[model samples]
Target chain A: MAKVAIVGSGFIGRAWAISFARAGHDVRMWDQSRAATGGARDYISGVLDDLASNDLLRGQTVDAVLDRITVVAELEEALAEAVHIQENTPENLDVKREVFSLIDALAGPQAVIASSTSALLPSKFTDHLEGRHRCLVVHPINPPYLIPAAEVVPAPWTSTETVERTSAFLVDAGHAPLVMQRELDGFIMNRLQGALLEEAFRLVADGYASVEDVDIGIRDGLALRWSFMGPFETIDLNAPGGVRDYVERYQTIYSNIFPQMLRRVDWAGEVMTTVEADRRKRLPKASLGDRQVWRDRRLMALAAHKKKSDREFGK
Target chain B: MAKVAIVGSGFIGRAWAISFARAGHDVRMWDQSRAATGGARDYISGVLDDLASNDLLRGQTVDAVLDRITVVAELEEALAEAVHIQENTPENLDVKREVFSLIDALAGPQAVIASSTSALLPSKFTDHLEGRHRCLVVHPINPPYLIPAAEVVPAPWTSTETVERTSAFLVDAGHAPLVMQRELDGFIMNRLQGALLEEAFRLVADGYASVEDVDIGIRDGLALRWSFMGPFETIDLNAPGGVRDYVERYQTIYSNIFPQMLRRVDWAGEVMTTVEADRRKRLPKASLGDRQVWRDRRLMALAAHKKKSDREFGK
Candidate 1:
């Protein structure tokens, strides 16, 4: 197991620590705030307890897994023995640049430094670094312990060897890493998310459907196919012959409706109010924690389902 | 249980017959072609056999369930004792118009007329009908036996009472029915599908990732959250506070990328070629049927998992 350094003791950083440690890596976590570091330890313990209860952990003892994570205040000590450094500081560009500079100064020559920034382009953050060749972005879905996909995005300056090594390391740490051939805004998952949200916002703005109904369109409708297979595979399976047949049959209708999707919404204004009001009606603000728990449980059930069925389903 | 009549004994029509019959409804299927009706009976029997192997049915006997489904050649005979009519003809506009006209002429006043057309506007087909108030589009995901979600979309002229009755009937039939507030092209499911396909095409076209990686981004990433909760509920429960907090944190990023989705593609060309080539690489044309069966088995297992764990962990 590699020694992994996790900078910043925020929610995402702590998640990365626990995920690495649970996968049997020796994880060193660092944060400027002592309180943040202390909170992360408690959070990690709680998460490990949750995983143990669910029988999702590979280790025999939660203590054994927790013992592998060392919460440190010194950045130099955190990066001293690490093979890869995962930076999860605030998403501010200036903050990221400062952190990456510090990381390059303290990290060993062979260590690969990666960020958990969701939107910031890696080139902007790592361009001034002396060890720019060894830096990239490894974006994980929230609660990376359960959801194992990571978008391994590289800047133009980032070496191919670094990308390959990072991919191998992430795979070894029990993550499915998708390599981004070029850096783009939102990467892969969020780009698809953006598209859905655009249409969802447009639908709500037009009063075509309530926020709840739009959600049902996905959760109950298209997402079922998506959970198992992707959109291309879905359309391929939908038509008898293959993609060609699917296009032949549905292309006309798709073309007819394609123009409607080009209609964009200002997601920042009245649309937000509409969605917020609708969502609040379904899930009250007071029950946010309960709803989050509900979301996690659903994710667990879904993960369990995918584990049992996806291979058989050819998804 | 309602006595359901399935008009047009194509693949979807026969599947509806078996689904309603499996749920213990008496089903009478009518096809213009005698050979098609015979084929539907055999197909329904085969599907029932598969369901029996999986312990999905708890009937007196497969023969008893099969006994409930009678194949009739005449439209009047099929609608004789039927309480609900499920029409699944070809996707031609004139064919839909003719079928609706015939159904309006033959079906009882109290019987609900629903079309299985994925693309046609319900108003266009049923506008000329005497029983137009009783008709609406009840679009099911393909192979409705495995996927239980049905979109009950009503046109501008569709009555509220009709929509409510259809929703209630579908619920009783063990299906999740989401009502569209108004008519729109592609309704809700396919529009969301269109949104996803647009971005997927853009990603592949821009060379951000391989077709395979984009598939993984969905099946392994966002789809995990979506299979259990709608996107609204997903974003609602994602952050610590709820949807409001999630938006506060990620809205800027989402807003930044939302414009990128506005860029449209002519999906009629090279994009199709790229996706087709990618699909053939993974699953050849010859292996599609076996793979589809694999998809069903996976869906069954996934559904079973959701059934089991949702009670325990789904909150």
Candidate 2:
């Protein structure tokens, strides 16, 4: 098992601890706050138990997996002998830069320092570091315990060895590692999501469809295929002649609708509020916590099903 | 049980027959080619059995469901005593217009003449019909027995009564129905899909990512939530304060990337070929037919899981 350090014991940090531990890596977790670090073990244990209840526990037993993670009070102790360090601090650039600076000094010479920032580019925080060549963004989906795809993005000066080694490390940890060609705003997942959300907001703002209708259109329609296949794969299987045939038949139509997609919607305006109001009507503020639990459970079930199906059918 | 006529017994029409029949509707099917209509019953039986194998069959037995569909040689006979006539002809406008004209004359006045055209607007085909008020587009995902979301788009002149009745008919047939706000090009499903495709193509073309990496990004990352929840609800629950909060944080980032999404990609160009080549590497051309079967089975399993999960946790 590899030695890994998870810096910042917040929700994502704790999740990274579980992911590494469950993959049989010895995970050392550290947080700036002593109270958060002290609570990390129990929090990780509770979440692991919840996953076990859903038949989503990664390893033999919760205790066996829990035994692999050590919650260290000091950042230096956490990074002392680590092969890789996963930094999950706040989204602010200043915080990330400070944390990475500390990690770069404390981490071993060969250790890969990976940031879990969803929005910020790796270069924003890692460019000035001594070990910047080994530093890259390894963005995971929220609650990485359920979703395993991690986007591995490298800065301009980041070495090819860093990308390859990090990719291998993620795969070894049972995560699907997707290495980006270069750093772009929001990366692939959010960019695709952003495109759809832009149109969705525009559709609502333009008074074309309700928020509920928009959700229904996806969950009930396109998502059925999308859950298993990507957009390219979906269109590939759409026509007899496959992707090219699909494009020839429908490119003009999509082009016509592309300009109609809203470039900018006032986030604080009626459009956002209308969608929020519609969402609240379905799920109120009081039940957000419960809905989150429900979402996690459903995610566990889906992951389990996907795992079984992939085994049955070659991925 | 409602009496439904499935005109043009192709893959979609036959699948519709099973959807309605399994839900206890008496289905009459017809195709212009007698040879096509002749083998439809057996073809449908095989698919129904496949769904049964996956524990996705709606009714008591395969034979019991199969007993409800009858393949008729004559179009007039098929349209006789029908409440809903689902037309699944070629995507060609002339073919649709000609077929709908025949169906409009032959079918009863109360029947909802719904076309299963994926990309065509309903007005293009049904505007001149005497029963145009009773006609609209009810586009189904292929193999509707497995994926039940049908895109219900109405022509400008179509009646509200037609929309309500058709929606009821679809739900009764155990399908989730999404009604479009108006007759837009490509409708809701394709428009959402097209937006994603545009971004995906541009990403690959611009060297932001490979074809495979883009697909992996969705199937592994976003599709997990999207399978059950739509984009709006996903972003709603993403942050504690809901969608407005998410937008307030990330709106500018998404807006920055929106213009980069390619407006048009030539179908016959290098981009399409490269994507197709990548897809072909993963799945060769010869294996496409078998892959289609595998896809259908996967859909069935997902449908079964979704049915049970939605029941356990209220949708």
Candidate 3:
């Protein structure tokens, strides 16, 4: 069994701890402030209870998984014996660079250092480190215990072995990694997401559709298929002949709309007011925390449903 | 309680017949060729059996729902007393215009005429009709009986009353209509879909990621929440404060990437080979039909799961 170290004990770090520990790894969590790591363990304890109730702890008891994660007093102690070191400090590039430098120097030479930064590329932070070859980005959708897709992005200077090792490690920890050929700005998920968001914002701003209507298009429509299949597979099955046939038949429709879609809609511009108003009307700001709990519960139920469905229907 | 006329008996028309009849509407299906209409019943019969087996026929027997849909010999007979007329003729502009002209002249003034054309705009076909104000587009993703979301797009000439009635009628028929204010080229679903597809194609074309990896990003990652909540609700709940807070914190990242996303990769170009090869490797061309069946079954199971989850979790 390999040891996993979490350098920053925020939400992302705590989430990584749950996934690593639940996967039967020994996890060590540490943060700059001692209170943060302590709070992370407490947060994880409550989450483990929720996960256990939802049958998501992989047949292990909550205490068993919780017992596998230890909050360490120092960053060096956390990284000392770890084969994999996950850096989840603040999103700022300078903060990440500084933290990665310390993790690189203190962690074992065999350790693969990974960042959970969704926004910053790996090169910006790790290029200055002495052991930069071992560093890559293992960005996750928040709360990795539930969401499994992570992006394994390597810097230009980073070794291919690091990418393979990180990808394999994520898979072992129950993640589906989108291993990149090289680094790009938004990676895969965000680019796809950003593409959709730009159109959604434009749809509302252009007075063609309402915020609710656009939501209905996805929530009730396109997303249903996307939950189980990707866009490529979706189009593959859409046409009789396959993906090529699908493009041949439908590419023109998208090509015509491509010019209109090129115009970027500023998410924080005038449309934000309408979007915020609609969201606030539907879900009052006061109950955001309660709704967050509800969202997590829904995700758990979906994950459980998917587990059963995958077994019955063939994964 | 109402008579609904389906002016074509293709797959979409048959699917619409099942949904409308299951909701207790007396559905009359007619097509230019009698054999096609005959085949539609045969197809719907098989689908109804599947729906019944999955407990998806809305607590009604397959025979009960099938009995409400009748194949009419003539268009005039079907349109005579119908409250709503759904035209599903060939998608060619000339064919739609000619068929719609005939439908307009024969149908009663009270009947709301809706086209199932996903390609052409409502105005393109309905402009010259005497009853143009009563006409609009009611586009559905195929097999609308299972997928409840449909785009109710209105032409410039379409009245507010027409939009309201169509939206209400769809809701009554167990559909979530994206009630669009004005008709655009791709409508809501396709526009959003097109945006994502463009980025997906670009990713493959630019050699940044593989087809399988991109698919995993959605099938496993982003689409989980999208199946229940939408983009607006997703970001609203993502941040601490709300949608505006999410925008304030994260919009810059998207805005920065938006420029890179503006360049459209020709989907029919080199990328088609890679995408098609990837898809074909997963499922050969011979198994496309079987995969389609699997997709439909998956959709049925997901729909059933969503129904229960929505009730238990509070929609």
Candidate 1 per-residue lDDT over residues B158-214, each given as its tens digit? 899999998888877667787888788888888888888888888887778777888
Q: Name every residue pair that clashes in candidate 3.
A: none
**Which one wins by TM-score: 1 or 2?**
2
The lDDT leader among the candidates is 3
* Per-residue lDDT over A123-184 for candidate 1, one digit per residue giving the tens place of the 0 to 100 score: 99999989999999999998888887899999999999999999998787778888999799
Name the regions of candidate 3 deviating beyond 4 angstroms.
none
TM-score of each: 0.95, 0.97, 0.98
Off by over 4 Å in 2: none
Q: How would the candidate models be sorted by DockQ, starting from the highest?
A: 3, 1, 2
**What's the residue-level lDDT of B292 in candidate 3?**
88
Name the best candidate (by TM-score).
3
Q: Report, for every candidate in turn, its global Cα lDDT versus the true structure.
A: 0.83, 0.85, 0.90
lDDT of candidate model 1 versus the reference: 0.83
Q: Under CAPRI classification, how is model 3 graded?
A: high
Tell me, by DockQ, which candidate is best.
3
**What ranking of all candidate models by TM-score puts the best one first?**
3, 2, 1
Supply candidate 2's per-residue lDDT for B142: 80
